[model samples]
Target: MMLDKVVVSDILSRSCVVTDLVAGNKVEVIEYLSQLLFAENIISDKALFIRDVLAREELGPTGFDNQVAIPHGKSPAVRETRMAVAQLRHPVDWETEDEVAVRLVILFAVRNADSGIGHIKVLASVSVALGDDEIVEQLMQAESREALYRLIVNNTGL
Candidate 1:
């Protein structure tokens, strides 16, 4: 899939944004984001989805530098590719690269049977956007769910 052809807004909306997220640990953050996907009708099974996410985390931590983490899972429990963005009320330990507590979490759920490249496209787009220090800084500083959504959608040109 072409990088420019994928837009995060296609799967992410203001409804997927969570501000003032209060997660005490990595598991709490994953479960909270998994529930959000279930609430949005993106995932049919919350338990399975959360399990897959945690399983992925066990392989390796997704936490990047600058207080950001991208925890993702591809599972049959998901009906479609979806993303949830959260800004924590306080940083939580997520085994980050820099050992800095994670304050921003981006969670993605993809259907296990998905054969198309859409999921990969979305993931690449998000990774690229997060790699930009300016964009990451803006995301970390966003005060509201609406602001967070706007920053992601705008920066990713979604």
Candidate 2:
């Protein structure tokens, strides 16, 4: 289950942006996804969804290092297994393994725990992508949303 399989262009288009994401932790990740779901007309109760996702985050932080974070949950509030990625213009403390501030956030919403494998595979793919310093540098240097998207799609085959 490559990320290209689960992360479609629409989800990528929705969340890819260069901005200062003021909320820097798990709470922020949940809120970001909730807002995305609402804005995309994918969910109605933003508060409930955000709360559930945040609660799941309490068990452990989702920060995967190399300036990336993948936060997800299996909750009824999730209408589908959707994914969205965002790049913050400024780094924010996310409490990852390397203790490096996170600049990119990937949010995933699934309706069942059985989807864990799919999510893990996607994360693995992303981790592989990030392992290439050139790829990560190119992604960070991307000037426009379209350029950033193309970089990801081309590199990840998404």
Candidate 3:
């Protein structure tokens, strides 16, 4: 798929957003998100998907500075390429590159078959969108799921 084909709103759902996610740690956060996605039918298997994400986490840090995290897993369990947002009630300790607390979790559920090219492109789009400090600030401060959705729509372009 092309960059133009990657619509932020297409992957993101207002229904899947959680503004006040209360998780004590990263593992709980991962499990919570995995369950949420699976419940929404975005993923076929919650347990397997969680294992995939944890395995990916073992490879390297998905958490970045400024309390942001983009955790992902590519598995056959993924039924859809979807993005779920969770703004934590409080920042939690996460294994981050800059070693900062994580307050914003963006979970990416990806199909294993398309892991090579499509995965990279979609992820890069989000990365580039997040590169803007203003957008990041907006995402961090968004009060509602609608606000979060609109921020992504504007920043990620048409």
Candidate 4:
């Protein structure tokens, strides 16, 4: 399935701000997700969940590009596979080969490691969507969460 189809407005953050790459990589993922769970009161101890997700991040960096990162983990902290997309207010140092800061972070949480294939497809779709400069620009300038969702759906045909 395409990311735009799976990514909802409730899971999209438009004004995330980050100063450093490491914090950006971790906070962008955990904060957006925590907000989602908080809104639903689905999970308690957001810090603990963030720590677990960061532990998964230590296994490898999720910074896929200068502009994007996809951090994910398989843990019970997530009841299902949730995908949260964030557009940072400013670029954060992502420590990539391109040396460009990351403007977007897509955090994925899956129920099982065996279900990674589905996550891979979502990541692939996100990569394709980010390839177009116009799409990227539109996403960056998206004024509202719903606008961002529509932009993604339009680009990914979801």
Candidate 5:
């Protein structure tokens, strides 16, 4: 998808937002998010998709200093481009530049045959919005899944 045409709604949905996710580690978090995508039919095979996500993780850290992690996977297992956002029930150590614990996780499921960096472009848009500390704080403080969904849509304008 074209960068200008991309919006947060393109990859995010009400069902994809989780406010009280409880993950003990990166693997648990990734698997949990993959399950969400699988249930939505966005990922055809959860096992393969999880492998792809882990492979991408090996390329480099997707974690940010602000208690956020954006882990993505582009694979044939992906039926659509979508994202899942979770505010963990508890924070966990992540491989971030500043070694900050991650409380928010953004998982991206991308189709392998995509024409361009559609997901990354969307991520750029999200990153820009997340740059505002106030927005990030509000997202972290969101009381429920529905509230977090609205907060992200309102702030990211996607």
Candidate 6:
């Protein structure tokens, strides 16, 4: 069976991409973005989704290199896969592999059954887009939500 390719634009919307976000810590960051998922009608239960995301974080920090943190979880509460990207006004501790404060937070949620290859493909594509220095630089310096959304969608070829 062939599954359609998943890309950033598929999950990310202009309304969900936030700039100058004011989050003090990792939990706050996730909480803020999770609200976007609920408001966008992607997740049915915000609290449940948040709990799952936090649990996934406990399993292992999603923070990686390049001051980027992609915090995500798979839960039954998710009605559809979605993403919210936030550019913080100031970096926050995410217990990243390099111990660098994360300036960009990309939050994603997926249906519980998607915990297979489909899940890996989605995350890998997002990671690959973020791995590009020019893309990351553009995202970090993006001044508006529309611009940020465009960057993600265009850079990911979604």
Q: Each model's C-alpha lDDT?
A: 0.85, 0.65, 0.83, 0.60, 0.86, 0.86
Model 6 regions more than 4 Å off: 1-3, 116-119
| Clashing residue pairs found in predicted model 1 | none
Put down candidate 5 lDDT per residue, 10-45, tens digits, no spaces: 778888899888889989999988888899999999
Q: What is the TM-score of each candidate against the true structure?
A: 0.91, 0.76, 0.90, 0.69, 0.92, 0.92
Instruction: Quickly count the clashes in candidate 4.
Output: 1
Clash tally, candidates in order:
0, 0, 0, 1, 2, 0
List model 1 lDDT by residue over 20-85, tens digit each. Answer: 898789899888888888888999999988998889889987998778899989888999877898
lDDT of 4 at 128: 83
The sequence of per-residue lDDT tens digits that candidate 4 reaches over residues 1-158 is 33423443333333322222234444654676566654554434456667767887788667755477767666666655556667677777664556677777766655553265545555566668877778888877877666766776567532
Better of 1 and 2 by TM-score: 1
Off by over 4 Å in 3: 1-4, 116-119
Tell me how far the alpha carbon of residue 99 in candidate 2 is from the true structure, in angstroms, after superposition.
2.0
Worst 10 residues of 6 by lDDT: 1-10
Among all windows of ten consecutive residues in candidate 3, which has the lowest summed lDDT? 1-10
lDDT, residue 84, model 6: 88
Alpha carbon lDDT of residue 31, candidate 2?
78
Cα-based lDDT at residue 25, candidate 1: 95
lDDT, candidate 1, residue 17?
A: 90
lDDT, residue 68, model 5: 85
Better of 3 and 6 by TM-score: 6
Model 6, 40-118: lDDT tens digits are 8989999999999999999987987788999988889998877889999999999787798999999888887666675
